[model samples]
Target: MSKTALITGASSGIGKELAIIHAQQGGNLVLVARRADKLNELKQTLESQHKVSVYVIAKDLTNANAPQEVYDEVQTQGITVDYLINNAGFGGRGKFHERSIEDDLAMINLNIVALTLLTKLFLPDFVKRNSGKILNTSSTASFMPGPLQAVYFATKTYVTFLSNAIAEELYDTNVTVTNLMPGATESEFAKTSGMEKQVYLNKQQRHIQ
Candidate 1:
């Protein structure tokens, strides 16, 4: 049977690509993002091309209650999610003190809080069934502290450790948690995360990998 994947940040870049790939594999998709128009456009394309059902949930996950809301909506639809892809995140460039507290907190809300809550909400179902997969988009930045992008780096580290611990916790079950640490990629991430203006991106060509 084809699986169903619920992916966040599915309107663009890595998230969009993941949705497409799942569709290509004949899997249904529940795509969540902030832009309704973009989500609808992607939904139309994926449904027409892959002949798979695609549900769109346009939500700004930074909101304190958004993760729970997403979970409730999914439950209402009666869609069994075989995969949960937490790919929604953005970074800001600046020294820690130089960055606004609000911005950094927002980063934490989405990168850490939202991801954690969604996992907590869905993991119970997976555990009950003894099946499911989770893919969280961490970053190589998690390996060390980032001088310019402080909060973003720290959040990814939290993701890495959290995912690792959960994987071990579910070792006996088929439910699995995976962390994806991607290096520099040419995507909207560069532009939104302020990495495009950083020196490293300017020094080398960023080809899609």
Candidate 2:
């Protein structure tokens, strides 16, 4: 039977690429993102091209209740998620003291709390069934302190550690957890984080120019 994957942040960036890959492999999808339009568009494209079912859930994962709501919705739809890809997160570029507290909190909520909650909600079912895979989108920033993007880096550290610990816990089971630590890539992340003007990006731009 073809598997089903639930992918958050499915509207754009790496999350979007993951969805396409799963579809190409003949797997069904539950695509979650705040942008319904983009989700629908991807759903149409993937379904037409790959003949896989795609369900879109537009939600802001920063909200405390969003993760639970997503879980409930999946249950209501009678979808058994075979793969859980927690790829929804954003970063803000600024010193910890200068950045907006609200933004930082939202980052924590989405990057840390939402990922943990979704894993918590889904892993039990995986354990009960003795099969499932979890792929979390952590970052290279997890390794060290980020001078400007402090909270973002710290949140990624939490993700890396949490994912590692849980993988160890499930070693006896068929379930698996993988953390992806990608460096700077061509994605919405740079623009969303306001890092387009940063030195590295500027240097890259100059080279391209």
Candidate 3:
């Protein structure tokens, strides 16, 4: 049987690509994102082309309750998720003290709290079945302190550490956790982070993995 994957941030960027790849492999999908229109569009396209079931959960994951609601919804649909891909995140480019506290907090809530909650909610089921895979979309910024994007870098550091630690914890089981650290790529991230005008963005080349 084809596996089912529940992927956050499936509206665009790396998340969208991951969803496409999974659909191409005949896997069912639970796509979660804030943009219903985009999610629906992707769902229609993927279902038509790949003949796989696609469910859309349009949600702002920064809300503390969103993770539980996603888990509950998945249960209601009786979808057994074999893969959990946490790819919903954003960064803000500014001095840490100069940025709005609310924005920084929202970043933390989505990047750290939401991801952790979703993992907590689904991991038990994976352990019960002795199978599952988790892919966390971190960033190359996790390796060093980001002067202009402090909170964003810190949150990703947590992601990388958390993913690696959990992978070791599940060493004896079939469950696996993988962390992907992608460098600058063609995405809305630069514009959303207010870094589009930065000199580094223009000069930096996309990292080839």
Candidate 4:
């Protein structure tokens, strides 16, 4: 039987691309995103193309209880997640002190708290079953301090560090954790983070060369 994978932020960008890749590999997918329409569109596309089952969970993971709610929804539907992709994230840019505190907190909630909570809640079954895979999305920004995007950078650092530590602790187990640290990929990330257009262009140029 094909493994079932749950992916957050499945409405767009890397998350959506990962969903496509999973479907290509003959995996059933449970996609979560705040946008119901986009999720539905994705579900249709994946199912039609791959002939695989697709489920969509529309949620804003910034809510403190959202992760548990997601897990509960999956259990309600009797979906056993063999793969979990914690790819949901948001970014804050510009001067740290000048940035909106609400945005910063939301980023913290999604990028760190929700991801960790989901991992903790779902990991027990994986341990009991002795088979599972987790892929957490970190960024190259985790390596150095981001001047304009302070909170976003810090949150990714936490993700990378926490994921690596857990991976080590689960070393000999059947569970495997992988972190993908893309170096400023071509996505809406720069725009959402309020990065300067020129800076984004420069980065894109460097990425291509």
**Per-model TM values vs. the true structure:** 0.95, 0.96, 0.95, 0.94
* Candidate 1 root-mean-square deviation in Å: 2.7
- Candidate 1 regions exceeding 4 Å error are 199-201, 204-209
- Per-residue lDDT over 7-116 for candidate 1, one digit per residue giving the tens place of the 0 to 100 score: 99999999999999899999999999999999999999999999999999999999999999999999999989999999999999988988899989999999999999
Residue ranges of candidate 4 with Cα displaced over 4 Å: 196-209
Per-candidate RMSD vs. true structure? 2.7, 1.7, 2.9, 2.1
- Which stretches in model 3 have alpha-carbon errors above 4 Å? 199-201, 204-209
Q: How high is the CA lDDT of each candidate model? A: 0.93, 0.95, 0.94, 0.91
Cα RMSD for predicted model 4? 2.1
Clash count for candidate 1 is 0
* Candidate 3: tens digits of C-alpha lDDT, residues 1-209: 99999999999899999999999999999999999999999999999999999999999999989999999999999999999999999999889889999999999999999999999999999999999999999999999999999999999999999999999999999999999899987777887778888846456653431
Comparing candidate 1 with candidate 2, which one achieves the higher lDDT? 2
For residues 133-205, write the lDDT of model 4, one tens digit per residue: 9999999989988888888989999999999999998998999988999886766666666666857688799
Count of clashing residue pairs in every prediction: 0, 0, 0, 0
Candidate 1 whole-model C-alpha lDDT, 0 to 1:
0.93
lDDT: worst 10-residue window of model 3: 200-209
Clashing pairs in 2: none
